[model samples]
Target: MIKKFLVFSALLCSAVFCNAQNAQLEAAVGKLTRLMVTPDSLGLDSILLDNLSYGHSNGGLQSKPQFMRSLLTGASDFVEIDLTDKQVVIQNKIALVRHTLSAKTNDKNIPGKVKLYILLVWSNEKTGWKLLARQAVKVPEK
Candidate 1:
């Protein structure tokens, strides 16, 4: 009976820990979307790892420096960003985040709308949760 109780208690504690972690991760994802729309170099730099791999739906890829440069220079301009259908999974110190990105953009002064499926990888580092990688693919239309 004592053994069973201990096992149950451990499981309960784990569940609560997982829920807390999920909430923190969700907030981090939201922060990322906001920074994407309104480029904040410091805020972004803090959340991204030095070797970030950012991939666009067009098969374009950017390293951390390249990504930061584009956002800072308004080259990869984002007028508005909306994310929906978000899901997050955590394993050890790594997290996999999936969501639908619906955004209105003015890239190179040309207005455009994009709906894409996005996958983001985050690692829980010494500072906090930092984005390690991201990939985007176009969402199919009906």
Candidate 2:
């Protein structure tokens, strides 16, 4: 009976540990999506590194300061953003997140609805998964 109780307790601990990791991932993704899709940029510093590399589907690149400034100024506006088909792979202190992003936005130089495959490399900092690099590829239509 003692052995059985120990086994059950171990299993419960394992389940809890796994669930906590999953929850962390979900929260990280949620924060990132909110930052990307909204005009407010207050919470972005917590989720992204100071030196973030943002690669766009249109073959453009933006640094962290540049991106934040663009969003702050009225240079970019998001109409809709849908993040789907997320796959997160965690290894040690790093994680790779791949997802399908469908978004409608109007920026100062660009305006349109776009669908893309986005891959973001995240590092498990002391806080959580902080985005370090991102690449967006245009989704090919069938």
Candidate 3:
């Protein structure tokens, strides 16, 4: 009976811990999105990993420095970003997040709206959760 009780207690604690971690990760993702739209270099630098791989719907990829430069220089300007249907799965120190992104973008001085299916990979590092990789595919209009 004691063994069973201990096992159950451990499981409960683990579940609670996972829930808390999930909440923290979700908040971090939201903050990163806001920083991306507003182009906060400091926040971006903090939230992104040094070897970030950011992939766009057009099959373009950018390294951490390139991504930051694009956003800072208005090469890929986001006027608004809305995320929906977000799902996060955590395993050990890695998290896989999937979401639908709807945004108004002003890229190269041209304004347009975009809907994309996005996948983001986050790693729980010593500092906190940092975005390690991301890929987005454009959603077709029906």
Candidate 4:
């Protein structure tokens, strides 16, 4: 009876650990989306690497500082960010998140919607999970 109880406890612990990891990934993505919507460049400065690479849906690469500057200068105003069909996978301290991103822009008198499939890599930091990299591709029209 003692052995059975021990086994059950181990299983329960494993389940809770898995759920906690899932919550961490979800929170990371949520914070990132919030930063984008608010155009909070300074807030992102601490969450992304100094030399982070951004894979734009328009087939361009944006460096970390460049990306931040754009948002701060109002060059890119994210009107809305919607995440859908999100899947989070974690291995050790690394996590991969895939989701459909629907965003609207209020840029230079141009207003339009852009839909893309995004893959984000996150790393667990001493502070929390920080976005390590991001790659986005324009969603193909059906």
Can you write out model 2's per-residue Cα lDDT over 1-142, one digit (the tens) per residue? 9999999999999889767877897788888887777756668777888889999888889998887777777586676799999998877777889999988888675788888999988887898878899999999999
Score each candidate by Cα lDDT.
Answer: 0.91, 0.84, 0.94, 0.86
Whole-model lDDT, model 1:
0.91
Model 2 regions more than 4 Å off: 1-12, 109-111
- Candidate 3, residues 1-142, lDDT tens digits: the string is 9999999999999999998899889888988899879987899999999999999999999999999999999999999999999988999999999999999999999999999999999999988899999999989889
Q: List the residue pairs that clash in candidate 4.
A: none
Give per-residue CA lDDT, model 4, range 47-80, as digits (tens). Answer: 8866678888788888888888877777877899
- Candidate 4 Cα misplacement greater than 4 A, ranges: none
**What is candidate 1's lDDT per residue for 51-112, written digit by digit as tens?**
99999999999999899889878888889988899888899999999999998988888899
Best-to-worst order by TM-score is: 3, 1, 4, 2
Predicted structure with the largest lDDT when compared to the true one: 3
Between prediction 2 and prediction 4, which has the larger lDDT? 4
The clash numbers for all candidates, in the given order, read 0, 0, 0, 0
Best by TM-score: 3
Candidates in descending lDDT order: 3, 1, 4, 2
Root-mean-square deviation of each candidate, in angstroms? 1.3, 2.3, 1.1, 1.5
Candidate 3 TM-score, true structure as reference: 0.94
